[model samples]
Target: MKKLVTLVLFLFILTSTNVVAFANSTPKIPVLLYHVVTQNPSGTYQFSLTDFKNDMAYLKKNGYTPLSLNQYYNILNGTVTAPSRPVLLTFDDSTSDFYTNVYPVLKQYNFKATQFAVTDWLDTNGHLTRAQLQMLSANGIDIANHTIKHQPLTSDWNTQYSAINNANIKLKSITNNAANSVAYPYGNYNSTTMSVLKNLGCQGGFTVSGGLSSSNSNKYELPRIIMANGDSVSVFARKLTTGY
Candidate 1:
């Protein structure tokens, strides 16, 4: 009886240790957000193409893997495991610079990214065209919703529904890919936002809130750190390591 009890205790300890190890091994992802990649410092949200390239190089050299929105969703849903030091690189606004500047750099790095497109603005003045979006989708870049007119979803329920639904429809019409994930415009949303998104078949949403993303994080309120203009390599490194 004594021997049996000792073996049972040993087995319990081993099981507990494995569970703790598995928990500790879970990846904490940092979703890095950018608006435009350009040479001109157009605004606080626009990053220079050089800086963006350096950031990507740093990520590659430091062993960071960029994951698409769909892969991140699967991670959250426990359908897949995250890669080593996974990060989600998200570009918002579907700016023309994405095709002219960002796409080439991403292709060079052999990396994937998610783009949150404001459907109504596409092919207008300096935004992406339907053809560009279709090519992007075909190239494995996940194009997500940023609403129809970049409207904040904290307004009335009907307005929110219209904006999101309209954008999703236009996105699918152009790219033949459903907008299953979204990034809230200006990172603004309300309590009703999650329910509405779920009703629309959205599996996840992103906010401008800065932090590390985890599998246990709220699916509709995931945090992202905005990459700003003139952020040095060290700052970018810190953002990746510490999620500032």
Candidate 2:
């Protein structure tokens, strides 16, 4: 009887401590990473316009706020206040489909998104044109750097640095605004690469790693969850709630 009583008391104290810790913890915001928005395309990297619209609608109805890339940076750096339900929607690659397919839906729902464009591929592979980039910025879409040639920073430092610099220059020419954020190509980066990025004025850089952002996370090197191509509406909803 005495042993049982001691065990129960210990368990109760542990449970109480856990509850206190959870109560004092801050909620983590989910950052959805998207690549291409297409018209019912069949691929792993493409989401239909309708599906995109549905996702936006879900956010709207759920009282979640869509954050721009800069806004996310502010949160990481402790410069801006975070909303109760905050989400950062990021589209990778500066594909023309983003302007034609994604932007319209975002505008329809009055939601903002961040686009990380490949400077070298802007005019190729149906990517966004220079004119469209300016228009996107004017319409409340943030333009970020995805590197000049979308090469891995850890593979070849010289080439990667040149590409990043070129992309920054091109993005500035298009939007006339300072671009300070980058998403690593192929989700590759090293300590040396991160050091170079820090020197280049990037407040934060994203990777393909999976996790939530917090005060302890490195602002220059952040992890992002992948949204596989052609994910169903149900799966997408689950992704939002579960932070996968």
Candidate 3:
């Protein structure tokens, strides 16, 4: 009887240790956000070309793997395992500068990225054109939805649903790939926003919150770290390692 009790305690300890090990091995990835990448920095979200390139070089040299929005979700869904040093590089607004500036550098690094595009902004005022979107989609960049007009989804249900669904339709018409995920405009979203997104069959959502994304994170409020024009390579490195 004494030996049997000892064996039972040993088995319990072993089980607990295995559970702890599995929890510790879970990956915590960082999603970095960007807006405009250009030589001429103007807005708060505008990032300089040199810094942007440096950031990419740092990520590449440090063996960081950039994943698309879909791949990120795959990791969370348990169908796929996360890679070593996984990072989700997300560019918002899908400005013309992304075509003129960011796309070339991303190609040079051979990195995959997600572009959160405002459907209404496309083909107007400095945003990416339909041809540009198609080209990017064909390449490694995954175009996801921001909204129809970059509007915040704090409004009524009808407005939120239309803004998201219409943008999804528009993106499909251009790239033949509807959005798998979405980023809430200005990080504004309520329960209504989530309902609209779920009804549209969205897999996940992103927000402007700064934190590391874990497998257990909320599906509709995954976090992202915003990049600014003045963020240096060192700052970028710190944010990447510590997850803001």
Candidate 4:
């Protein structure tokens, strides 16, 4: 009887392990964050063009498909079929570097990506022009609001609320596409900020909290891993593996 009970316990352990493995076998999604896709400008947020290209190449070679935030939300919400290898490529700040450096590589792979732009900063020195944004939309890229002045949404109720609302209005007015997503400037946010975003009809928001997102996570305060200088191809590859 003792031997029979021990065998039964061993079988139970094996069955449990198989069950856990089966659950984990489901594909995990990754949402990668990027800012200032341009030449390294010393203290500024930037990614070297070579690294950007290599990362894109790695994604392509590894059979990764970049999805827009809306598509990703739909997958999480069970409204659409999720890709076998779903990954979100997001660029913030709408820099001219994106047009000059990043666009070609994205185009080469025919991968869709999300870009958040501060409406008030368009057409300034290093930022992207309105025409460039329109071109990006026409090329099938997803554009979202990054606030009008790039202020942290935690400042105050009125200003913070209006910043998000006004930016979305202007972004759509320019690109004729619904700007439904927001990225917290400097990854700053509070409870009130999240409330404002919900009232403004924002489908989702991004934070620089550094981790993988899931269906159980907050859609409005999603965390993302930043990609920047010193992140080599191997590091990038590892990030994809960890889903960060």
lDDT of each model, Cα atoms only?
Answer: 0.89, 0.80, 0.89, 0.84
lDDT digits (tens) for residues 43-162 of candidate 2: 786777777778888889889888877776666545567775778888898988988888888998888888999988987868998889999998899898899888888756676678
- Worst lDDT 10-window in candidate 3: 17-26
lDDT (Cα, 0-100) at 14 in candidate 2: 90
Candidate 4 residue pairs in clash (backbone atoms < 3 Å): none
Give the CA lDDT, 0 to 100, for residue 123 in model 4: 96
Model 1 misplaced stretches (Cα beyond 4 Å): 1-24
Alpha-carbon shift of residue 123 in model 3 (angstroms): 0.8
Per-model TM against the reference: 0.89, 0.84, 0.89, 0.86
Question: Clashing pairs in model 1?
Answer: none
Candidates 2 and 3 compared: the better one by TM-score is: 3
Report the Cα lDDT for residue 207, model 4.
Answer: 92
Q: Which stretches of candidate 4 lie over 4 Å from their true place?
A: 1-27, 39-41
Q: Lowest lDDT 10-mer window, candidate 1?
A: 18-27
Models ranked on TM-score: 1, 3, 4, 2
